[model samples]
Target: MDGDLVVDGNITDVDDGAAALIVLGNLRARNIYLAGDAKLVVHGHVTAETFVGDMTDKLVMIHGDLRATVSIFWNEFCPDLVAGTLHGRTLAPAYLDLSTAPIGCLADPAPEAPLSRLLAPELLVTGAPGPDDLTEIGIRGDALRDRLLGGLPLTTTP
Candidate 1:
């Protein structure tokens, strides 16, 4: 994009053939979901509620700071380069390359579970929620993950 991009909802890339994106300015979004091979580069800062990068060969490079409530990198091959500071909770594979280590952040190594398993339903409902909200519903983790991986929206009207 030529200038700053603001997304009210989410930015999801599930297609394997998705095109690469280059943002000249900052990017503000609710969430970012990447499960494709396309590369994403942001020259300016990136502000989001959550960022989920599943199994993919994409490289995400941010020239400026990245501020989010939660950032999850599920695959070791997914390389994320952040030139500036990173602020938030980061759940990533130990081998993943995040150029700059986060500051005063809670970093967690992703478990053997799928990407969706790390995301709680409350996150989709509310931008940020308490950790205990994960079990507030009756759905199993695996089941929820499967549904999410299958392209089902977590929060939708019947």
Candidate 2:
């Protein structure tokens, strides 16, 4: 798109063949969920509360800087490349290669807790939860994934 794209709620699915979403300008959203071989290319900066990629073939390329509170490469096949600086927390499997991108504040979930239990999807979209909130009680795994796939905001307001 030409100008900045601002999404008040989450940007989910976008599972097209290639380059599902392309933005010439900046992109700002509450959260972004990419799956099913989805690809997102942002020429300008990206500002989101949370960014999650959940497919082996998924790709998220940001030419400009990216600022996200929580960024998760949920699947081992997902390749997230940030050409510019990346600022915020990131969660990824140890097997995933994120060396190409400079990630700040990488958070690893406790051994007892799986990656899915790290954060509450609803709070991620509706409230401002920091890295410390990972332990907070909330939905997770299938329930969270289903909510994201449903593409309905947990609350009417962001």
Candidate 3:
């Protein structure tokens, strides 16, 4: 895989080549291993099992989950990291920065914490189902989404 291996679809395997895997679109694959100075450059979401190799600079901005051996750049793309996990020794530099990144709160099956607890108490938030009361919750959700998308810092306090 070299000279811009652009894939508009999914890539089953990319471990055989020592070139850069540049995905122009989404990459829905598993077990991606690169060797001999291989690189990965994805312009879209990449859902994979594991990525083994030293990722180069071109490999920036991933919108999905990546359980690689390391995670260095998790904020170069959108802040809203839907679901993903970066593992390995290459994530030390970005560890502290992840706290402010969207990837920091990525919950797959939903966390054990209650949703109401995540919002401000002054927002009059609740988990119960009411007639017009539910509208307030919806508004809060919208606000949160807007803040996240706008890359604005969220206030967790009441």
Candidate 4:
């Protein structure tokens, strides 16, 4: 049933059970998600954006081909990730400006990311530190997304 959909703003498809939303185009919204086993596939770029409840949302790179220059966050004063394979500039780790709402990632490592992708590219921690646990957030756009999306080759530094 070609159930995939592409949109540009505030995507909400909680109606369907366990659905996948493909963002092949540009999108900007305060919140975007699917209610049932929902997964978000970011294709291009997301700038000055935010997403809530990404931990349980099953976020991952649908096709390893495409890369994004988007900066998205779960909270205002949280570390925003410029998700993509390219490198050059870095997202500010100290997001004190987002004082209104504690960024989801800033609180604790997202447990879903067992692979620890959040600490891989960078680590942004808030408040005092003492054996804290934060779930890992990730741009699971591995080599798979690159081939499917037919995007530029990714470069990772070790």
The CA lDDT of each predicted structure is 0.60, 0.62, 0.37, 0.33
Better candidate number, 1 or 4, judged by TM-score? 1
Off by over 4 Å in 3: 1-18, 53-60, 63-158
For candidate 3, the lDDT comes to 0.37
lDDT of 1 by residue, 45-66 (tens): 8888666666667778888877
Q: What's the alpha carbon RMSD for model 1? A: 8.8
TM-score of each: 0.62, 0.66, 0.31, 0.30
Please give the lDDT score at residue 155 for candidate 4.
24
lDDT of 4 by residue, 40-138 (tens): 665554332223222233444423221222232322222222243321122222443433332222221223332223222323333443242222323
lDDT of 2 by residue, 64-109 (tens): 7777665666545444556666566666666665664333223333
For candidate 4, the per-residue lDDT at 30 reads 31
Off by over 4 Å in 4: 1-9, 13-17, 33-36, 62-158
Off by over 4 Å in 1: 95-158
Q: What is the Å distance of residue 155 in model 2 from its true position?
A: 13
Pairs clashing within candidate 2:
none
Which residue window of length 10 is worst by lDDT in model 3? 69-78
Model 3 vs. true fold: TM: 0.31
- What's the true lDDT of residue 38 in model 3? 40
RMSD of 2: 7.9
